[model samples]
Target: MTTSENLTAPRRPRTVDEHRAFVASLLAPMPAVEVPISGALGRVLAADVVSAVALPPFDNSAMDGYAVLAADVAAASPDSPVTLPVPEDIPAGRTDVPTLRPGTAHRIMTGAPMPAGADAVVQVELTDGGVETVVVHGHPAAGQHVRRTGEDVTPGATVLTAGVVLGPPQIGLLAAVGLPTVAVRRRPRVLVLSTGSELVEPGSALAPGQIFESNGPMLAAAVADAGGEPELLRFVPDDVEVFAELLAEKAGGVDLILTSGGVSAGAYEVVKDALAGRGVEFVRVAMQPGGPQGAGRLDGDGPAVVTLPGNPVSSLVSFEVFVRPALRAAMGHPHPMRPVVSAALGEALVSPAEKRQFRRGVLDAADGTVHEVGAPASHLLASLALADCLIVVPEGVSAVDRGVDVEVWLLEA
Candidate 1:
C-alpha cells in the first residue's frame, strides 16, 4: 500500500526557472475585503486611497510666538524696537478669532490657526512681553513659521495606492487622513501536511529509525510570515490509502496544499503512490539538499499542491525557493521574491555540474565591499540559520576564487 507498491520510474529533473514559472502561472490573487484600519497591517491594499480633506485644513502657526504684519516689523531691529498692543490670544483648536489690526500683534501658540491679516510670526524669546504690550527686537520674513493648508496632503490626491503593503507608517498616514476602515486583500488559506511513517512529533519519545517532525511547524511559520493562514494537517502514515483519504479531507477548504517528504526515488514513498497520475507531477530538481520537488493541482480539488523534500533544511529552503513566492502572488504582494545583489566570495567554492547551488552566507558591507560568511554546504543547517543571504552559483561553473564578485539573495535588507 506504500508508494513502492505502486510502480513507476522517476521523471527527468526540471530546471529551477521552469518550476518557478509553472508555480507563478498557477497562482491567482485573493479577493478583497473591508477591515478596520487597526487590523489592516501587513495586508495589501485593494483600492486607491484618496485624501478626503487637505492636511492642516487651515493655515496654522508652526511656533509659539506673536503673529504680526511683516510690513510693521520690517524696520524693527535690536537697537530700535517696535512696540505694539497685544490684541487677542490664539490657541490651538480655537475657531473664534478676529482678524489682526495694523501695528498690533496677536499672541499665538503653536498649531493654532493663523488669524487673518497676519503675515508672519516672531518667537517669544525675541520679544519683550507684558500684560497687553510686547516689543519685537527681530523682524521675521513674511509667511515664516506658518503651516499652510494642504502642505502635507491635498484633497483628491492618492494617499496610498492599490497593492501597497500596510505598515506602521502607512497605518499612521491612513489614520491622519481620517480613515477608520481600509480595504485589503484577504489572507490565503494554506494546509500543511507532513508524510512519513518514520516521523514522530516533537514531544513524543522517538524509537529507532524515527525522527522528530519539524517540517510541519517550520513550514507553518513560513506560510504565516508570507501572509497565508496555515492549517496544520495531522501527520499521514506511509500508506497510500490513508494518505489519499487525508488529502481528500483536507483539500476542501484550502487555497494551497503543502506536503513534506515521499516524493523522492525511494522504495516506500506513499505520497507519490497516492498522487500518481492524479493531476500532480513529482520530479527531482537540479538542487542539492532539496533535490526532490513536486507541484500541481490535486485530482478533485482546485487547490495547488507543492511537495517538498524531507530534511529540515531542505524543507525550509524549498519553501523559500518555491512556495513563498507563489503564496505572495496569491495574496497580491507587489514584490514576490527577495531582492538580490552582487557580492564578493570571501572563500573559494566547488559545485556540481548540473545543479545551481544556493550557499548560505552572511553578507557584510562594512567597507563598501560585500563578503560571504561561511562554507557553501547545503546540509549545514547551522550556517543557514545564521546567514542573511544565499550566494548563487550557476550550474556548470565551479571553483570561485576568493575576492571574486558573485550574486547574493538577501533575506532581509
Candidate 2:
C-alpha cells in the first residue's frame, strides 16, 4: 500500500518491499542551504552550478620560456640560428602588459600572461637560457606553448548539476570557477534512541539480566557515515510514560527520530506500548532476522520515526535495507543504495518459506563465489563484523545447492 494512505498500524503483516517504500516516504527532502566551498565537501548540490569566470581567466604562458612572434622564430635552427634581444622579463602574475617588440623576445615564466603582441613561446631549453639576449635553436609554430582564455571552461557553462555529490574534485572545480560558496542540500539531523530496561552501557559492571547496549552507538555511527547528522540519546528509563515524554520534548529539533528495540512481540515492548496509538505503526515485515518494523510520525505530527528490532545484526541489516538509502536520498544523494552483484554460492543453504533471508558472507572474488560467515541468528555480531557482503535469498525458495547464483550486496564501494 502507498504511504499516502497513512502508515498507521497495519491490520496484517507487510512485505519487505512495501515496508521499505513506506519508510522511504516518511522523510521529506531536506531544504537547500548555502555553505562555503570548504564546507561543501561530501554534500549534494541542490541547484546547478554555473561558472561565473572562465577557467584560465586570461591568455597565459603554458611553459617557462621566451615570448616571441611565430615568424621571428620560424627560421631559427642549428645551421641558421637566430639571435634576438631580450627586451623584458615577464614573470607570472605581472600586472602591466608588455608588448613583445617585433623581432625581440621577452623572457616569460609559466602561467605568465602572454604579451599583447606575442603569438608563440620558445622554450628556454632550446635557447641559451639568456635574460638579455637569447639564441633560438628551433622553430615555434603559431600559438604554441600558450594557454588560451576560455579554453578549459567558459562563463555561464554548467560545471556541476543538481544532485551531484560534492567531493574534493568538485569542490576544487567550484574554487577554480571563482565561487566562494555553493548551495547544497542540508544533512538530515537525526536523534538515535534505543530502549529496553535490560540494556546496560559497555565497560561497566552489569546486573544479572542486563547485557551491554550496542544498538544506540552503532546506529548513530551508521547514520553519520551515511551523511546525516546524528545525535545519540541513551539511558532513558524503559517506561512508556518516560519514552513518550522524551519524544515530545526532543521531537521538533531534528529531522528524523530513529529508535531500536521494544517493537517485537514481548512482555516489555516499551516502543510498541508508548507509540501504539500516538502515530508510529509497528508491523512484522516478511523478512528474515529484521521482520519487526515500525514507521510514521510521533503524535501524528512530530518528527518522522522508524523503529527497528533489538538484535544487533537485525538492527544493522534493517538500517542497510531501509534507513541508509532513505537518509541518503533525503540528503539529495544521486545513488543512494549499496552496490549489488551476483555470485555463485560456495556452499548449500536453506531459507524459511515466505520470508527473504539475508546472510552475512565473505566473497571469494577470484572464484566468483560467496560463502556464509555466520549462522542465520539475528544476534550474531561476530559474523556481521567479519562479513564483507550479505548474501540474499529471495522469498518462496527454501533450499539451494552449492554453486547456485545468489544476489550479493557489497558492503564497501
Candidate 3:
C-alpha cells in the first residue's frame, strides 16, 4: 500500500517504507544559486557542470628532464650516450618558448609546456646533470612522458552531472577547469523546536521532574549533517496557544520545521493538540523507538513540519529513517538513503513481532559481523553515539539469533 494510504488509515501501524515514501512526496529540491566553487562543498549541483577549458590546457612535460625529438635519443645508450647542447631552460609558467633544434635539447621542468618539434622527455634521473651540454643515457619512445592537452578532461564535456554532491574531488575539478563559481541547489533552511514544559537546557540547574533539553541541538546537528541549514528555537511550553503563536511567528522564511516531544498520545501533547486537524497527521508507525510520528505542511504557504518523539534515541532514529532523506531530497541529491549491507549478527536478540526494530549496532567490518551497541530501549542516547549502523529487523520476525543475516544501514558513510 502507498504511504498516503497508510497515513489516512491510522488504525494500523504503518511500515517504514510507507512512512518514508510519504515524506518523500512532501519535498522537492530547493532553488538553485550560484556559489563560489570554494564554498560549494556539500552543496548539490543544480545543473550539469560542463567544462569551460580542457584539463592541462596544453601539452606539458610530466617530469623535470630534457625535451627532445625522440629520434635524436632513439639510438643513445649508457656506453654511447648522445651528447647535445642545451640551448635554454623551460620552467613552469614560461610563455615564450623556442622550438627544439634538430640536433639539440632543452632543459625542462615538470608542468612546462613542450616546445615545438619535441615529442618526448627523458627524465633528469636518466641523464647527466648538465646545463650547457646534457647526456641522455636511455632511449625514449615518441610521446613518452608528455602530458597531452585534454588528457584528463575536454572542454564542453559534462564533468559533473546534476544532483551530484560537490565534495573535495568535485571542487578540485571545478577549480582545475578555471571556474570561479558553480550553480548548486541551496541547502534547505530548517527550524528545530523541542517542545515540553519539563525540558531544561543543558548545564542549567534542573528542578524536580525537569530533564535537560537535548533534542534541539541533536536534531539541529542531524539537519546540518544531512546538508540542511538548521536553527534551533528555544524550548516551547506545553500549551497549545503558545506553541501555535511561536510557530506562526517564526515559520516564515524557513523551508521546513522539526519538533521533538509533545507528539504522542499523552494528555499534555501540545504539538498534537495545536496541529491536529490543522494539517499534520499523527500516526503510529510499525517501528520500535520511533513509532510515534507526525508530518504535514503548514497553513497557507508555511513550511513543512515533522514531529518526532522526544526520547533521544527515538528522535535520532526518526531523523535517520525519515527526515534525513527528505532533507537530502530537498538538496537535489539523487541517492538520499544511507548505504546498506547484509551482515551476520554476533548475538541473538528479541524484538516485538508487530514493530520493525532499528537497533543500534557496531559493525565489525573485519569479520563481517554486527553486534548490538547497548540496550534496545529508546532512551539509550549514549548507545546511539557508539553505533556505526542500524541493524534492521523485519516486523514479522520476533527474534534474530546469533549469526543470522540481516540488513544493516551504515550510519558512517
Candidate 4:
C-alpha cells in the first residue's frame, strides 16, 4: 500500500501541547522489580517505603561527655568545679553497662546509648578526666547534649513515597532503616533504529553522497537520560521489505520502537513505506527542526514507535519534544520536560511564520536576561550544545526585540 493510501485526510497541524498529550496517553508505567539497595540510584520506587525501626533506636549522647543527673551539675561552675566518681565507661555499640547512679557519672562517647537515670551530658572538654574521678565545671540542663530516640525518623512512618527517584540521601535512609533491597519500576526497554541509504557510522570513510549517522548514538543517549534502556538496531537501507522484516523480528520484547530518519516525504523513505498502513500515522507537526513526526504501534506488536526527522538536530529536538516525555511517563516520572519560565531577551530574534520556534540560548538569570547562544539555524548542533535553554517563540509572531519578556525552557537546574 502507498503512504497516501494508508493515511486519512491531513489533520490540522497540532500545537506542542496537543502532541505532548497524545504521546503521554500512549505510555504506561512498566512492571516493578526488587533491586538491591546498592544499585537503586536513579530508579523510581514502585511502592511506598516505611521505616522499619526508629532512627537512633534509643537515647544517645550527641557528644563525648559524662552522663549524669542535671541536679548534680547545677551548682558546678568554672571556678568552683564539682567532682563525681565515674562508675562506668560507655562507648558506642556496647549495651552491657548498668544504669547511672544518682550521685555518680558515666563516661560516654558520642553516639553511645545514654544510661537510665541520666538526664544530661557534661562535655568531656569541660571536665578533668581520670579512671574513677572527674571535675565538672559547667552547669547542664535536662536533656542537654542528648539525642532523643526517633528524632530523625519514626518507625512505621512513610519515608519515601511511590514514584520517587532514589538518590544518595534516599539510599542512605533506606540503609539506616535496615532495608537491603527496594522495589523500583523497571526501566523501559526501547528499540532504537536509524534508517537511510546515504548514512555511514562515524570513523568510516564517507563516500561521495554519504554522511555519518549521528542520530543513533544521540537518540540512544537521550533515551538513557530519560531512564530507558535503549537497544540499538543495525542500520537498515532504503528497502521497505527488509525494514518491515526487521521490525517484525524485534518487536516482541521491546517496550517502544524509536527510529530517526526515513519518515519524511522523500521518495526513498523506507520507514514510512513499510509502516504506512500498519497502524502508524505520519504527520507534519507545527514546529521547526522536527516538522515530520510519526507515532503508533509497530505492526501492532511492540509498545509504540516514534519516527523523528532525518537531520541530527531535528532528531535530537524531536526526542526532547516527544520520546523523552513518553519514556518519563512509562517510568512514572512526575515532571517529564525541562522547566519553563519567562525571561527578558538580551537580543532581537526572528522566527518562521505560523510555527513555534525553539531557539537555543544561554540564560543569564543573574542579570534577568536570555542571550542567544549562536546562530539559530535548525542544523547547528554546536549551537544546541552550548545552549542552556530553548527560548520559546510562539506561533504567528515574527520578531522579538531586545529586553522583551519571552518564555524559556531551562535545560538544567
Candidate 5:
C-alpha cells in the first residue's frame, strides 16, 4: 500500500482498549487437567476442591501432655498436686486407644488421637513429666489443648474454591485433604518468535550490523512469570518464507504464537509480510511505544498470534499492557489485569494528543508518587529494567503536571 492510500485508509488507528480486547478474544479458557499436587504450583483450580476427609481427620491432642478429664485436675495446685496413675500411652497415628477412666491419666504426644472420655489435656510441663505416675499441678479447661474433629475443615466442604491459584499453602491444603492430584487449568504453552536478520544470539561475537537478540528471552520470561509455559524461537531470519516455515513447524505445539518486531510499515517487515492476508489482522494501535500490533490465528487453524514491536522497551511494555493479561484471562484468572493504583507524577510529562502513553517509571509507594525512569524513547532498555511500574497518560491529554495523580500499573515480583 502507498503512503497516500495508508493516510486515506478506510478507518483510523485502533484504540488501545479495542486492540487489547481483540487480542484477548483470540485465546479462550483452557480445559481442566488433573495434575499431581506436587506440580500444581501457580496453576488455577478449575473446580472447587472438596475435602474428602476432615482436616486432622479426628479429635486429637494438640500438645504433648497427659489426657484427663478437666474435672479430674480441677483441685490440683502448685502447692498441692494431684497424683494419677498413667496406664496407657497415645502416640500420633496409633490406633486402638483405650478409653480414659475417671481419675486416670494417659500420656499423650502432640497430634495423638484423643482418647475417649478425655475432655482436656494437662501439659507435661504442668506435671512432673512422668510416664507411669503423673502429678497434675494445674487444671486444663474442657476442650483445651484438643484439636476437635471437623474444626479445621469438614468432610465435603470446599477446601479451595474454583479460580484460586495454587501456592504452597493451597497445595498443602489439598494434600492435607488427601487429594494426591487436583484438577486445575492447564498453563498456556506459548511460543515466542523473535525475528530479525540483524539479530544474533547473546554471547556470540556481533558483526558490524548485527546486535544481540534479547526479545525472545525477555518475552519468554514474561510468559513464564504470567503462569504460562514459554518456548523460545529466537533469531528468525527476515525472509518471509523462512519465518512462515518455522511458524508452521512450531504452531501446532503451542496455544499462542508471540512475535517481536517486523509489524511496522518499514521495509523487510517480515511478520506483517508473512502473516498478511493469512488470517492475522495488523493495525496501529493508538498507543505510544507500541503503536504497531497484530493479533489473529495463522491460516485460521493454527494457534493464536500476538505480534509486538521490536524495540526492547516497547516489546516488554506491550507484553505487560496486552499479552500478559490476555494469557492470564485465558487461563481462568479472575483478575487478568495487573494491580493498578493512582499516584502523582514526580515530574511533569507530555504525551501525544491521539496516543495513550505508557511510560516506564519507579513508583515511590511511600511518597505516593511515581518518577520517570528513562526517556520516552522505546529503544531505551536500561530504563525499562529499572522501572517497577508504568505511568499511564490517556489520549487527548497532552501533558501532565507534577503532583497530578495518574493511573499506574504496578509490576509484579
Candidate 6:
C-alpha cells in the first residue's frame, strides 16, 4: 500500500527490529579513500592491511645483559664467577654487531640485534652489571633472553583485517608494518533541519510562546561523533511551501537529510503536511519517546530523509537508535550499534505494555548497576544530558521492579 493509504487505514505499529532492518537495507558502506596514517585515526579500514616487513626485522636481545654462549656460563657462580672480556658494546640500533668469541662475551642492551655465535644473554643484574670484564654469576639457559625475528609480526601477514577501526594501537601497528597510507571508508555527509514556528535560536530572547530550537545542533554534533559530516539549517517555519523549497535546495549536497518536529499527526505539522504523498511514510513505531517516525527518499533518488520528533529527548534518542547506526553502516563500521550490557536496575520502573521504552539511565560499570536519571518524558533534556546509558524495557513487559535485570545500551562508548 502507498504511504497515504497506510496512513488512512488501520495503522500497525512498526517494531524496532522491523525499522532497523529497513534502515540497514537503505544504507550501504560509503566509498573508500586513501588517507595517510596520521589522518586515518577513528576511520574504518576499507581493506585488509598486510605487513610489508616483519617487525624487528632481525633477532634481538630482550634485555640489557651480556650476549654469550650458554655453555660458557654454565658453571659460573658467585663463589667462582667466570670472567670474560667484553670486546664490544651492542646498544639498540647498532648495525655493525661483532660476533662473540668462544670464551668472550658481548655486552648487549635491550632491543639490540644479537651478535652471531651467541645463543643466550645473562641479564645485567645477574652478571654484576659489568661491561669490560664481565663477571658472570648465574647460569642462563640457551635462548633464555633472545627475541626471535618476526616474533611479533610476520611479513605478508594480514596485520589488520577489513572493517577494523583505526585507533591509537591500530595506527601504531600500521606504522610498524610500514604503511604510510591506508584506504578507509568515507564519512557520510548529513543535513539537519529543525521545523516549528514557535522555535527560536539559542541566545535570542524568547517570546511568551517561543522555545529555543535545539534538535538541529544536537543531532549535528551527534552525526559528527558517528563519523558523519553535518550541515545544520536554520529553523524552518510552519509553512509547507517554504519547507519544501529549503529541503530541495539543501538535500542535493548531502547523503541524508534529517528533520526534527512537524512529523506527528497535527494540523500545524509542516513536515507531515509538506512531504505527505511525496514519498515519505509516516508511521507510529512501537517505542516510547520516539514513536512517531518517517523515512523516505526525496524527489528522483535525492538524499534519504528521516523525520524525528521535536522533543529534545525524543530527537536525541531517535538519533541514537536509528540515525547513528545508519551513519556507522555507511562508514563501514563492523559493529554499528552501541555497546549493550545487561545490568540490574537500582529502582523500580514502569512502562506501557504495548510500547517499548527507552529511559535515560546512569550505568555504574564498576558494580553493574543502572539508576534511572529522571522521569521518562520526551521533553526532559536536562536528564538526558546526565545519562550515560539507555535502559531498555521490552514491549512484552509492563512493569520492572528494583533489582530486575534489564538490557542497557552504553552511550559513552
Give model 5's TM-score versus the native structure: 0.96
Candidate 4's C-alpha runs over 4 A off are 1-10, 129-131
Candidate 5: regions farther than 4 A off: 1-7
Q: For all the candidates, what are their Cα RMSDs to the real structure?
A: 4.2, 3.7, 3.3, 3.1, 2.3, 2.9
Per-residue lDDT tens digits for candidate 6, residues 322-382, read 8899889889888999999999999999899898899999998788899999899899999
Give me the runs in candidate 2 sitting further than 4 Å from their true place.
1-12, 78-80
lDDT of 5: 0.93
lDDT by residue (tens digit), candidate 1, 1-413: 56885556555688888888777666678889999999999999999999989997889999898999999999889999899999799989889978999999999999998999998998887798644999999899999998899999999999999999999999999999999999999888999999988888999998999888778988999999888999987578899999988877778878888998888888888878888888888887887658888888887458888898877778888888888888898878988897888877887787886887777778877743355555654455676778787778887786677788888888865
**Residue pairs in candidate 3 whose N, alpha carbon or C atoms collide under 3 angstroms:** none
Candidate with maximal lDDT: 5
lDDT of each structure?
A: 0.84, 0.91, 0.92, 0.87, 0.93, 0.90
> What C-alpha lDDT does candidate 2 achieve relative to the native structure?
0.91
- In candidate 1, what residue range of length 10 has the lowest lDDT sum? 367-376
Weakest lDDT window of 10 consecutive positions for candidate 5:
49-58
lDDT of 5 at 146: 97
Q: TM-score for model 4? A: 0.93
Candidate 1 ranges beyond 4 A from true positions: 1-11, 128-132, 367-379
Per-residue alpha-carbon lDDT of candidate 5 for residues 1-413, written as tens digits (9 for 90 to 100) = 99998998767899999998998999989889999999999899999988889877889999999999999899999998999999999998899999999999999999999999999999889999988899999998999999999999988898889999889999999989888999999889999999999999899998999999999999999999998999999899999999989987898878999999999989999999999998999988999999989999888877899999999998998998889999999989888899999999999999999999999999887989999998989999998888899999999999999999999999954
Q: Model 6 reaches what TM-score against the true structure? A: 0.91
Residue 122, candidate 1: Cα error in Å is 1.9
Q: After superposition, how far is residue 180 of candidate 3 from its true place, in Å?
A: 0.9
Error of 5 at 114 (Å): 1.0
Determine the C-alpha RMSD for candidate 4 after optimal superposition of all C-alphas: 3.1
- Residue 198 of candidate 5: its Cα lDDT? 97
lDDT of 6: 0.90
